[model samples]
Target: MPVGRTRPAAAVFLANLVVASGLAHPAATASPYLLALAVLAYLLGLRADRAGPALVLFGACAALDLALCAVLGVGAVHWFYALSLIPAALLLPWLAGRYRQARLALVHEGWERARSLEERQRSVAEQARLRERTRIASDMHDSLGHELSLIALRAGALELSPTLTGQDRADLAVLRAAVSDAVGHLRDTIGVLREDTEGEEPTAPAVEPVEELVARTRESGVTVHLRREGPARALPPLVDRGAYRVVQESLTNAIKHAPGSTVDVGIVRRADRTEIRVTNSAPPSGSPPAGPPPAAGRAPGHRGLTGLRERVLLIGGTLHAAPREGGFEVLATLPDQVNPERVRSTGEPREESGSPASRRLAVARSGARRRFVAAFAAPVGFGLVALVSCAYLAHQLTGCVLRPADFAAARVGQDRAEVARLLPEQQFRYVPDAVRALPVPAGTVCAYYRSNGNLLDRVDVYRLCYAGSRLAAKDVLPG
Candidate 1:
């Protein structure tokens, strides 16, 4: 399904079909009908677009061929030509069909691949859009929320002023109430647009969490009971960050909806993992009104625990936050190494206990080389064999149109007209100097005549070496 992957297979199939057909060399070496057969092969297999006419056309060609062989007298050349054509006729069309189907499959696969890439691109763009919206929401909540709170503060203080009349005081109180309601409504609206599932940062704080993170929450007036297990030790950056975020979000939630709640925070460290647990008692400030949950949380409209869920899950941790025993509890367990990027500089690379690196690399290279040969050897090997076969057939098929018996009437003092009758057509052609230099004298004008199968199925050129209208040497020469 990769781009341009179908080209080699199609090319090989097409090359085999063409080479095997023997139509490339259409000289006398190859039968004239082969060219016709080549045309028929492609037309019958591919161009006709219907089977009935193709079969009829094939039958007609075969009948005509057999009749011609019977009438003209069959020979080695005829048999070889017929033998070669049989396989090509049957197999070339099938090869053509396979090639056409493979091409279609390749095109369809390419389109599907393009569609998948487009889908992935759209998904990436959507994620970016959502991330931008989250950033914008966070920005609005921080800056605009502060300004709205300031407006309510100023309005409330104005209502307490001695210079203000009863109606003015009433109007100031109403303005403060409206501003408070607007801030609450803005928080709810922005919360809907924010999606915390996207893990923006791959790595978190590159150090262990100090006591200060928990201390700050307690300072906000929540009674937090802290519990610690195992010897206190520095954790991996990913695990450390995941643990801190769990405590941070849980404490924040307890303070927001259930102020004065007794929060019980626990941290348990082990060789392979670190765990964090936060539980809170029934709130001294009393619980807030029930509402619909945000994305993933026990209570509705609680975005804090929902955001923490993503943070915990991103670090390959498990988190559970729900109401338990008339109070809320959040628990998380983080692994020491979530991913390769999370491992610290001091972390040792894990390998198979006794395997050598050189051995592994050598094995991989051997496998790759074997695969390369397996992929390419067949096409290359077949092409060589096809070329050799074609060349040999061409050699056998090629011969002098003249026969050795045609030169039997030539004599030492034969008349020119008589000799001319005995000579084959296309005589007096050029001959090589190696044989021409020996028999024919320099001053005597000479004529070249070629013949086949006089010696070892090879072509021999006969030169009627004449001197003063008398034959001097009429010896057989190599072509």
Candidate 2:
């Protein structure tokens, strides 16, 4: 039904006529219906599932064309002319059919491959998202757990027997219980939310030293003072870790708000309590606040300090973060016995699993390989077909003789059938003025047999006059 498909058949029909125009005694009067029928045959051949019918149709047209030329009193068609017509009638339709089929196969394969690649990319992205979320949750547990436990300890340490009233002791007990419950709830919630990421065991991070935290802050161009009130060699593992985080967060805040100010960091360790205080001299009052994470110019997110505060409360700690006269300070007091359970992370970094870049290379290689093979094979196939066609044509044309010797045996009186046998393998025709100039016997046919080669080859022709069942005269013409 598509116009594009029918156009080639119509074009082939017109081309067949154009090629025939250069032949001897072209059928300028070739019937329109016959030409349409030939085109229809070609189209049918193209549409047929099998090639046999199409080949038969082309062969039939070639035979019928020769018969028509003889019946029309025209000279024989040259072999080269036949060759030209064969490609128009047979080759084009055959190639078109093959192209149509191959195109369909390529389209199907392309669509299928494209869909598969799309799914793979989508899956990779989803996996990356899940992996990052799991890491974030694990990081929160490590950084915030100790802070919460300190809050409960601070509440339980208050004494109301002599110095505090009864109501104050009851409130302290309620606050301690509340902070403890919140820590358990937060851990359970994060654990349930991370269940879908994987079923892997957790990895525990190494405990960080407080001195390393101060050194990193100094490297970032912050003037910092470190003062320790007691020896810290015997600190518990969790308190040592939490003490480092408190310093890290405080120094990060200092750099963000007071880019070129001096900060004083003091750590005091005792048998019952440990205190960490970080105070930073404010920058010039008119200066815009520095690279705090919540600012638009940086990677901004919700204040993780709220979660930090929650962590401190669960571990019984008192944290005060406020702006003093011309300076900002974050102070935390933690019980020496702060121990909230540590959960390790088993989730690996996304890049460690496999690279998306490597997968992209594999996909690209497959696509390129298919296209390269197709690109190389098509031209080779067409060239070989053309070579074989030319070879077949040369062998067929070689069988004919186009010299004076082809009709040398014919005499003035010979059986017509015998004289015909002696004639060259081609149609015969009368010279233009043969009817009036040549003397021909009655009830006989007189004609000139053209023995001409294509384009560059010169050949001889012969004139013959036949009467009844015998050849009355014959003459070999000039080349």
Candidate 3:
């Protein structure tokens, strides 16, 4: 396995070895070589994705150390001092490493979240741009298609007039057919832009009145009756365009669906609103459809009424189209003044606050923040416990060491009672193996003490032996 992948296992193995060796010889825990190895093991554990076997191994070692020490009849203070090494050497470094790993993960997740959000925003902007382009194309198609129909109607009328020569009539027929072909091409271009999909189209502005539109249809051999009830007044551009479109579209539908029908158009301009109503009577019996059939490549389904409804609603108006008295009827009410600001505001696209992607990202960020807090809190808490324990162990261990001056003051043949006051309250439990193996005089009981109280530094040990209630010999042992 790669080094990075094997780090956790190495940490567990090395940490267990260090801890086990320290328990066998308590003084080894203080050696720089062993302490450095323990620190390295903890640093390796930081790479583990979860808490690994190191902690369990440490607990097992601690229990075994205490049990072995108990069987050997070691002092309670020595056992407690030995137990404190577990947290200071193993648990503290591991906790700190885990915290460092968590901090790095939090930062990485933040950058990823920002990148994902930016991508989603870019996608949304692209979609909105496409939709706007499609709407503009639809609007152009509606406006131009209506005007072309009017031109074709005029050409047909000229072709029927008796005053025209035979050559003139043939030219007029050609002109009308060309106009029909132009309309078909326009439809095909819009269909290609929209991929055969229908979209809401807005009406183009026109200064023509409903009366002029009706008169033009009448001249084209269609029976159209126009009635204007309200006083003549200059209307807003949107309302004027809407009124013209309502009559034009209704007439086109009557001509195509019910030929030879009598169409009635009523325009009533009130103080607050303009009302337009167009109704066509049922077709005469045996009357064929008036307009030419749809051309090749033209998409099916009529989109005129749908476009009209969208345009009317855009200007804060209402439009209704339904069948009445065996014919079609269209009723529209347009307000005199529409709020341009409101219309523009509605047209502009906005980011949706409740979108699923947005919600999911928010939740992920929240979770990352919580984990970061927890990672920091756990290490700090573990560190505090370790510090308190280490401090207590240090205090107890300091009491067990004999100062160099005290060792120097003792005499080899001094009375035991006088020398007793120079001795410390406890004996050093971490005596070196060399000192323990030294030859002792016959019938002498030997006790070991560290030369100094400093916990981290390697120092000499003093061995004092007593024989027959008198100090027989005292010597310094290297550590």
List ranges where model 2 is wrong by over 4 Å: 1-84, 87-138, 150-172, 188-195, 198-458, 461-479
Top TM-score model? 3
Sort the candidates on lDDT, descending order.
3, 1, 2
Task: Show the colliding residue pairs in model 3.
Answer: none
RMSD of each: 15.1, 17.9, 9.1
**Over the stretch 335-448, how does candidate 1's per-residue lDDT look in tens digits?**
877775433221223333344443444444554454345335634655676689767644533443455676766777776666667765555333444555564566676676
> For all candidates, what are the clash counts?
4, 23, 0
**Candidate 3 residue-wise lDDT, 323-383, digit = tens:** 8998888999999997775455323344455876556556656655665575567667767
Higher-ranked by TM-score: 2 or 3: 3
For model 2 the local lDDT of residue 436 reads 30
lDDT of 2 by residue, 333-356 (tens): 877765333222222222221555
What is the total number of backbone clashes in candidate 2? Answer: 23
lDDT of 1: 0.57
**Judged by lDDT against the true structure, how good is candidate 2?**
0.56
TM-scores, one per candidate: 0.50, 0.35, 0.55
